[model samples]
Target chain A: MALPGIASFLVTIGTLACIWGLLALGLNVHYGYTGLLNFGHVAFFAAGAYASAVLTMPPPEQVSQANYVIGLDLPMPLGFPVSLAVAALAGGLLALLIGSTSVRLGSHYLAIATFALAGIFEDVLVNETWLTNGTFGMNSVPKPMRETLGAGGWQVAYLAFSALCLLGVYLLLDRLIDAPFGRLLRGVRESEDAARMLGKDTNLVKLKSFAIGGAIAGFAGGLYAHFLGSVVTEQFVAGVTFVVWAAILLGGVASSSGAIVGAFLLIAFQQSTRFILTIYGWIQSVLPEPLSGVLPAIFAPLPDHPSFVPSVRFIVIGCLFVLVIRYRPEGLFGDPNEVTVMGEEE
Target chain B: MASALSQFLQAVAFGLVEASVISVGAVGLTLSYGVTRFINFAYGEFLAYGAFLAFFLSGAGAGVVGLPVAAVVAVLLVGALGVAVSRVFFRPISDRGALPLLITSIGVAFILRYLLIAGASAEARQLPVPLMRPVEVAGVGLTPLELGVVAVSVVTMLAIHLLLQRTMLGKTMRATSGNRSLAEVAGIDTDAVIRKTWFISAAAGGLAGILYGVLFAPFRPTFGFGYLIVVFAATLLGGIGRPYGAMLGAVLIGLMISLGSTYLSASYDQAYAFIALVGVLLLRPEGIRGGEF
Candidate 1:
C-alpha cells in the first residue's frame, strides 16, 4: 500500500479507535468508575447502529439498488443529525430498560444480564430480517458528504468529524467524572453500602450512569455506521463488547485518557500483527513443513482471501489481553489506587 | 388440536435432549464458578475443545470406544490449560478483582475459538461416526444418539452426585467452594481441590461437547461461541454455585427453547433462554434449588 493508502487505513483504524475509545469511556463510567461489570456493552452499540440505520434507510417503498438508507434524493444535512440523535436515543432507552431490571443485581448478575441482552439484540437483528436486513447488513448507508465531496473528501471530512466527536466526548466525560454526580458514582463503586447509608439512591445513580454511557456508545455507533458506510449484526457481537472492555483495561479502566490511548494501542497492535505475519510468509515457508504448519496454526485462522484479516486481529487481541492482565493488571495508564474500584465488597 | 399437542410433546422431547447437552455444559460451568467464584467465560471453550478433539481423534480412526478416550483426553488437556491459566493469569489478579479475570477469560475464549478456526477448516466438519438411527416413539421420532445424550446426562448427574457425596476429593471440592480460607485452614489443600475442580468441570464440559457433536452430526469452529450465552443463562438460572441446579435449569431452558421455537419463530430460541434467565433472576435470584448467589 502507498503512503496515502496506509494513511487512509490508519485513518480508518483511528476513527474506529476513537469510536471504541468513546464507548470504552462509557464503559469506564459503569465498570471502571462504578465497579459495575457489564459484559454486554455492545448491545447499546448495536442498538445505536441499528437505530441510526433504520432511521436513515429510505422507506421500504422508496428503496433502491444502492442500499443507502437515508435515500440519496433526501437532503444530506438533515439526515446526518437525525441519525446521530436517533442512535443515542435508542441506546439510552435500552440502557434504561436494562438498568431498571438488571442493574439492581450484584456485579456478577449485572454482567450476565448485559451479556444476555447483547446476545438477544444480535438475535433480533439476525432473525428480524425485515427490520435490519438480517446478516446481509445495510450497506451504502450514506457516508456524510460522500456524494457531494467524493470518497476521498468524505473520508477526510469524516476523520475530522470523528476526532471532534472524540474530543468533545472526552472533555465532557472528564468534566462529569470530576463533578458531584461522578464522585457519587465513584462513591458507589467504592462502597455501595456506604453510599446507600448516606441517603443516596445508588441504584438510580448507577442507572443514570448506564443510560448516559450507553448514549455515548450510541453516538460512537452512529459515527461508526456512517464511516463504514454499513451496519451489520456481526459488528455488535459479544467479541466486540469484550474488545471494548479489553481496551478499557489496557488504557486504564477509570481514566478518560486511558480509553483513548488503549483503543489506539490495541488496534495498532492488532494491525501490526497482520503486517508482521504477511511479511514473514517467506520465512515461514522456509521452515520445516511440520513446524511451519504448527506455527501458522498457533495464530488465528488466516482466511484464504487477503482482505479478511480481522480474525487474525482478534487472536492477537486475545493474546494481548492475557499478557496485559498477567503483567499489568492496572492497565497501561491505570492507577494503583483505582484497583480498589474493582475489589470485592469487604 | 391433537396434532398441535403431539407437536408440543415432540418439541418438549427435543428440548429435553437439547437440555441434556446444555445441562452437562451448565453443570461444568456451575462447578467451576462454585469453586472459583468467577464466571469462567472460557467454559464454553472446553466444550469446543472436547468436540474438536473428538473430531480429530475419530478422524484418526478412533471408533465408538475411542469416543470416551477422546473425551477424557480433551478434558485432561483443557483442565491442564485451565490450571495453567488459573496459575498464570487468574491467580495474579485473584485478589485484584473480578473484571480483569472476566476479561482474561473472555480473551481465552476468543483465543481458543480462533485457534480452532485457524487449525481446523472453517467449514463445518462432521464427526466420523455413524448417525444414530432415529427411532419413533408414539409418533415422535428421536435418534439413538439423542437418547444416549439424555441417558448419559442422567448417568453423569448421578455420578456427580455420588462423587460429591461419597468421595474424599468431592468432599474437599465442596469444602473449598464453601469457604476457601477455612478449607485451607482445615488442611483441605485448597489449590489441589481447585485444580481437581477444573479437571472435573472441564471434563464434564468436554463430554457434553462430544455428545453434542455426536447428536448434532457436524460441528463448526464457532459452534460453542453461539451456545455459550444459553449455557451461561442456564448456569445462572440454576444458581451460580450448584451443579444439580444447573442441570435442572438447563432442562428448563432447553424445554423453553424447544417449545418456543415450535410456537414462535425458530430464531427466538435463544431469546427464550434469556427470558428464562431474567425471569429467574426476578423471581428467584438464587435459582430454583436456592444456593449461594
Candidate 2:
C-alpha cells in the first residue's frame, strides 16, 4: 500500500466503521438497554437508506433512464435533515409496529418475527423493482455538500460526518441510558412481573425502547446511503443483521462504548480478510523454500479462491458467534447479571 | 373460463406437491421443539445437506437403486450428524434457556451453510432425476415425479404418526414433551428419548430436503435456507409442537404460495409465505391446535 492507498483505505474503513458503529449503537439500545431481540434490524437500515435516497435523488424526468419511481430532488440543505428524519421516523414506526405484538413474547419469538420482517423487506427490495429498481439498485445517490467539497475532499468530509453522527448518537444514548426511561426499560427486561407490580407499564416502556433503538438504526441507514452513493438490495441482507449481532455480542451486551469498539473491530476483521491471498503470498515470498512450502501446505485447505474468501469470513464469524455465546455469553464489557436477554428457561 | 379453471387446478396440484415437501420439513422442526423445547434453526441445513449428499451419491453411478439408497443413506447420516451436533454444541448449553439455544442454533446454521458453500461451491446443481412429462388429471397437469413425491410424503407422515402414536418410543416422547421432569421421575430416560427424537426429526428433515430437490431441481446451497421461513409458517400455522398441525400448516402454505404466485406475481412467492406466517404469528400465536403434541 502506498500513502494514498493507505489513506483512502483508512477513509473507507473509517467511514464504514462509523456507519456500523451507529447501527451497533442503535442495536445496543434495543438489545442492550431494552433487551429486545430484534433479528431483522437491517429492515430499518434499508428503510432509512431508501428513504434518504428517494427523497434526495433527482426526479424521474431529470434522469434520462430512471429505473426508480420516487424522487423528491430536494437540495442538500433541506434534503439531509428531512431525509434523516424520515429515516428515523420510518424505523421508529416499523419498530412500534413489530414490537407491539412480539415485545411481550419471549425473546426467541421476537427474534424469529424480526428475522422474518427483514426477509420480507429484502423480498420487497428484490421483487418490487418499480420502488427500489429491483436487483439493479438506484445509482448516483446525492451526497450532502458534495458540490461544496471537491471529489478528493468528499471522502474525508463524509468520514468526518459519519464519525460525528456516531459520537452524537453515543452521547445521546448515554444520557438516555441513565435516565428514568432507561431504568424503566431495564426494569422490563429484568422482570416484567416485578416491573408491573410496581405499576410500570412495562409493555409501553419496551415498545418505546424498541422505537428509539429503531429510530437510531434508521438514522444510521441514511448516513450509510450517502456514504455508499448508491442503495442496492444486496447490501441489506440477513447477513448484515448477524454482523451487527456479532458486534453487540463481541463488544459486550448492554454497553454503548463496547458496541462501538466491536463494530470497528468487526469491520476491520471483515476488511482484513480481503488481503488473505496477499498475506499468503507475502509469507511465501519472505520465507525459505522449505518453510514456504510447509506454510502453503498447511494453509492449502483454506481457500485460495478470492470469491470464496467471503465464505471463509462468514465461517469464522459463525464460529465466533457460537464461541462467544458458549464461553463468554456476557461478552467482554458486560456484567453477567445485567444481561437478561438469555434469561430463565422458556 | 376453461383456461382460468385449469390454471386454478394446476396451482392446486402444484400446491399439493409443495405441501408434501413442507409437511415433512415442518414436522421435523416441530418434533425437535416438542421434545427439546428449542427451534433448531439448522434444521434447514440438515435438509440441504441431505439433498446434497443424495445428489452426490446418485451422480456417482448409483443408477436405478441409486436415488432411494442414496436418500436413505443421506437421511441416516444427517440424522447422526444432527445427534452429534446437538450432543456437542447444543446439549451443554441447553440449560441456558431457549434464547441462547436459539442464537446458538443460528450460529450453527451459519457455519453449516457457509461450509457447504465453501466445499460444494456456490453454484446450483440439479439432482440427476430424469425429466418426465406432466400427466393431465381433470384438466390439471401433474408430473409423475410430483405424484411420487406426494405418495412418499404421505407414507412418511403415516409412518411418523404411527411412531408417535403406537410405538413405545412415541409414548416416551409424548410423555417427555408434556413434562420433562415428570417423565424423568417416571423413569422414562428423557435423555435417550431426546436423542432418539433428534435422530428422527433430523432424518425427517433430510428426507424432506431430498424430496424438495426431486420436485424442484437445480438447487443451490441456500435452497433449504430460502425455504426455511415458509416451513416456519407451516409449522406455526399447524401449531409449533404438533406434527399433525405442521402437516395441516404445510398444506395451507403450499397452496397459498402456489396460488398466490400463479395469481399475483411469481416474484412475490416467498413474500406470500411470509405474510401467512406473520398473520398466524400475530392473530394466533398458539396455532390452530394449541395444546400437547
Candidate 3:
C-alpha cells in the first residue's frame, strides 16, 4: 500500500493523540487521583461514542438499510457540542451506577465488576443492531464544519478543536485537583481509614471523581466520533483502556500535561513502528534483486503473516510497560513523587 | 410441564460440566489470591498456554507427546511455569497495591496471549482425541469426554482438598493466608508457601484448560481469554481467596450461564454471568462464603 503524504499522516495521528490525551486525562483523575481501579473503562467510552453517533447522524437514504434513534439534521458545529453533552451525560450516569455499587465493594471487586461490565457493553453493541448497526458501525457521522471547510480543512479544524478540548479538560482537572475536593480524593486514595477519621465521606469522594472521569471520557469519545465522521464498536475494546493507561503512566500519572505527552508518545511509537513494515516492503522492492537475495530472506513470511504486526506491537508495548512499571513509575512527564499507586513511600 | 422439567434437568447437567471446568480455574485463582492478594489476570493466559501445550503434545504428527501423559505433563509444567513467572515478574516489586499488580498482570496477559498467536497458528485446533459415544442418564445426554472432564476436575479438587487439609504444607499455607506475618513469626516460610500456592493455582488452571480444550472442540488460543469473565465471576461469586467458595460460585455461575443461555439467546451467555455477578454483589457483597475468604 502506498503511504499517505506526511501532512495527512500527521493530521490523522495528531488528532488521535489529542483524543487519547483526553481519555488519559479522564483515567488519571479516576485512577491516579481518586485511586479507583476501573478495569472496564471502555464501557463509558462506547456509551459516549454511540450516543454522539446516533444523535448527530442523518437518517440513511434507505430506511430499511439503517435505523437509529435520532437525526437532529442540525449543522456540524451545532450538533457537535450537543452530541458531546449527551455522550458525557451517558458516561456520567453509567459511572454513577457502577461506582455507587462497586466502590462500596472495595478495589479488587470493583475492578472485576467494571471489567465484566465492559464485556457486557461489547456484547450489547454487537447484538443491538438497531443502535450500533451490528458492527458495520456508523459511517454517516457529520464532522464539525465539514461541509464549509472541505475534507482536509475539516481535519485541520478537528485537530485544533481536539487540542482546545484537551486544554479545557486539563485546566478543569488541574483546578479541581488543587481545590479541597481534590485533597479529599487524595485522602481517599492514600488511606480510606484516615480519610474517614478526618470526617470526609470517602465513598462519596470516590464516586464523584469516577463520575467526573466518566464525563470526560464521554466528551473524548464524542470528539473522536466527529473527528472520524464514523464510530465503530471495535474502537471501544478493553485494549483501548490499556493503551490510554500506558499513556498516562508513561507521561506521569496525575499531571494533565503528561497525559498529552504520553498519548503523543504512544501514538508516535505505534505509527513509526507500523511505518517500519512499509519501509521493509519498500526496501524489498527497491533493493534490485541480488542485494536483496544477499540480505537473507529471514523475514520472508512476515509480509504474509496476519498476526505479526499486532503481536509485535503488543509485545513491544507490554515490555515497555513492564520496564516502566518496574523502574520509573513516575513516567517521562510526571513528578517523581506522584506515583498513582498508594501506600508506598519511597 | 414434563418437557420443562426435562429441559431444566438437561440445563442442570450441562451446568455441572461448565461448573467443573470453572471450579478448576477458580481454585487456583482463589488459592494464590488468598496468599498474594493480587488477582492474577494472567491466570487466563495460564489456561491458554496449558490448552495449547496439550494440543502440541497430542501427536497430530507435530506433537511432542500424547494425551493422559500430555495431561499430566501439562499440569506439572504449567505449575512450574507459574512459579517462574511469579519469580521473574512479581517477586521483584517491593510496593504492593491492587493497581500496580493488576496492571502488571495485564501486561503478562498481553504478552502470553499474543505470543501464542504469533508462535503458533491463530486458527482453531482441537485436542486430537478419539471420539467417544454420548451417554444418556435420566433423559440428559453426556459425552464420554465430558464424563472424563468431570472425573479429572473432581480428582484435582480432591487432591487440592487433601493437600490443603491434611498436609503440613497445606496447614502452613492456610496459616499464611489466614495471617501472613503471624505465620512467618511461627516459623513458616511464607515465600515457599506462596510459591506452592502459585503452583497449585496454575496447575488447577491447566487442568481446566485441558478439559475445556478437549471437550469444547474448535477452540483458538483465545478460548480461555473469552471465558475469563466467567472465571472471574465464579471466583468473585465464591468469594475471593476461598477455594470452597470458588467451587460453589463456579457451580452457581455455570448453572446460571447454561440454563440462562438455554432459555435466552446463546449469544448473551457472558452477559448473563455479569448480571448474576452484579445482582449477587449488590444483594450480598460478602458472598455466600465471603467470611472465610
Candidate 4:
C-alpha cells in the first residue's frame, strides 16, 4: 500500500474509533457509572443520526429524486451544530420516556424491555419509509466544509473534529463523575435503598443519568452520520449495542479513558479481520507442505466462504465477552470494587 | 359477510399454527426463568440449532423414517446440550445474580448463532419432510402437518402439567423453583432439579424450532434470532416465569400477528408484538396471569 493509502486507512479507522468511543462513553454513563442496563442505547443513536440526516438533506419538494420525508435543507455549517443539539434533545427526551417505565424493573427485565424498545424503534425506521427512506436509507448527507477542504483535507479535518468531540465528552464525563452527583450515582448503584435512606430520590437520579447518557449517544450518532455520509437503519442494529457493550466491558466499565481504548482496540480488531484471507495465504506459503495441507483440511471452508472472516470475528468477540465476564468482570481498567453484579444490592 | 367470516377463520387457523410454535418456546423460556431467575437471551439459539440439526439429519439419511427420528434425536441432543451449557457457563456465575447470567447468555447466543452461520451457509434450507397440501376442517384450511403441530403442542403442555402435578420429580422441581434454599433445606437436591429443568426447557424450545421450520419452510440461520422478539413478547405477555401464562400469551400473540398481518402489513408483524408487549407492561406488568408460576 502507498504511504498516503496507509495514512488514509489509519485516518478512517481513527474516525470510526472516535465515533465508537463516544458510543462507549455514552454506554459507560449508563452501565459503568450509574449501573443502568440500557440495552437499547442504539435507539437514541439512530434517532440522532436520522435527525441530523433529515436536517442536512434538501426538502422533499426540492429533491425530485429523494425518498425520505421531513428534509430541512440546512447548510452543513448551520446543520452540524443544530443536528447535534437536536440529536441530544431528541435522545434525552426519549430516555425520559423509556426510563419512566423501564427504569423501575429489575436489572434483567429492564434489559429485555429495552431490547424490545430498540426493536420497535428499528421497526419504525424500516416501516416509516417516508421518514427514514425505509430500507434504502438517506444518502449524500452533507459533509461539513467538504468544498472548502479537498476530499483528503476533509477526511483529515473530520478526523480532528471527531477527536475533539471525543475529547470534549471525555473531559465533560470526567468532571461529571467527580462531582457530588457522581457520588449519588455510585450510591444508587451500590445500594439504591441506602441512597433512599439518605433522602435521595434514586429513581429521579436514574432518570437523569439515563437522559444524559442518551444525549451523548445521540451526539455520537450525528457525528457518525456526517462521517459515513449516510444514515441507514442497518447501521443501528442490535450488534451496535453489543459492540459498545463489548468496548465498555473491555476498557473497564465506568472509565472514560477505558471506553476510548476499548473502542480503538475493537475497531482495530474488526479491521484486522479484513486481512484474514491474505494472512492465511501467507501462513500457507510459509508452512511445510504436510502441515499446510492439514491446516487447510481443518479450515477447508474458510478460503471459499465470503463471510468467513466476519463469522470468525463475531465468534471471537462473543468468546472474549464471556471470558471477560467469567474471569475479569471488572474489565481492564474498572475498579474491582465496582465489579459487583447488578441487582445484588436489591 | 360469509367471505369475511371465512377470512377471519382462515386467519385463526394460521394463528393456531403460529401459536403452537410460540407456546412451546414461551413455555421453555418461562420454565427456565422460573428455576434460573434469569432470562436467557440465547434461548433462541436452541430453537435454531434444533431446527438445523433436524434438517441436516433428515437430509443425510433414510427417506421415510428419517424425519421422526431426526426430530427425536435433535430434541434429545439439544436437551443434553442445555445441561452441559448450564453446567459449564451458568453454574459458576449463577451466584452473581441475574445480570451477569443474562449477559453471559447473550454472549453464548452470539457464539452459537454465528457458529451455526459459519457451519451452515446463509442460504435458506428446508427439512426433507414429505409435503402435503392444505386440508379443510371447520371452514378453516390447514395442512395435516399444521394440525400435527397443534396436537403436539397440546400434548406437550398436558405432559408438562402432569409432570408438574402428578409426579414426585415435578413436585420437587416446583419446590425448588419456588425456593431453592428452602428446597435444599428440605433435603431436595436442587442441582438435579435445575438440570432437569434445563433439559425440559431446552427440549421444548427444540421441538418448537422444528415445528416452526416445518411450517415456515426455507428457514435461515437467523430464523430463531429474528423470531426471538415475538417469543419474548409472548413470554412477557403471558407473564415471565409462568408457563400457563406463556401458553395464553402465545395464543393472543399468534392471533394478533396473523390478523395484524392480514389486515395491516406483513412487515410490521414484530411491531405488532412489541405494541402488545408494551401495552401489557404498562397496563399490567404482572402479565395476564399476574402471579408466580
Clash totals for all candidate models: 5, 2, 3, 1
lDDT of 1 by residue, A135-243 (tens): 8887756676777776666677787888898899889988899999889989998889999999999999999989998898888888888888788877788877888
Which structure among the candidates has the greatest TM-score? Answer: 2
Worst 10 residues of 3 chain B by lDDT: B94-103
lDDT of 2 by residue, B59-141 (tens): 64344447888889989998998899899889989988887888788888889888888877787877878889999878988
Ranked candidates (TM-score, high to low): 2, 4, 3, 1
Off by over 4 Å in 1: A1-3, A61-74, A272-278, A281-312, A344-346, B60-69, B291-293
Candidate 2 TM-score, C-alpha based: 0.96
lDDT of 3 by residue, A1-346 (tens): 2235888889889988988888888888888887788877878888888888888888765345575545555566876778899999988888888788777767767778888888888999988877788788887788777778877777777788888888888888889999999888888887899999988888888889989998898888888888787888889888888888888878887778887899899998877777877787788789986788754468665544677677778877776667778888788877766674464444
Model 3 lDDT tens row, B1-293: 87788889989988999889999998888899889887878889888888888878767525777687887888899899899888988887735555567778878887778887888758788888888877887778888888888888898889888988999989998999999999999999999999998898888888888878887887888777777878888888888788889899999999999998899988888798898887777777667785764
Model 1: how far residue A132 lies from native, Å: 0.7
- Against the true structure, whose DockQ is highest? 2
**lDDT, candidate 3, at B17:** 95
**Where is model 4 more than 4 Å wrong at Cα?**
A1-3, A60-65, A282-298, A301-303, A344-346, B60-65
Question: Which window of 10 residues has the lowest lDDT sum in candidate 1 chain B?
Answer: B58-67
Candidate 1 lDDT by residue in tens digits, B1-293: 87887788899999999999999889888888888888777778778888888777764434544666666676677667667757765776676556667767888887878777766646676766665667987768898778877999999888988888899988888899899899999988888888888878888878878778877767787888778878988887888889888988999999999999998888788899998887777777888887542
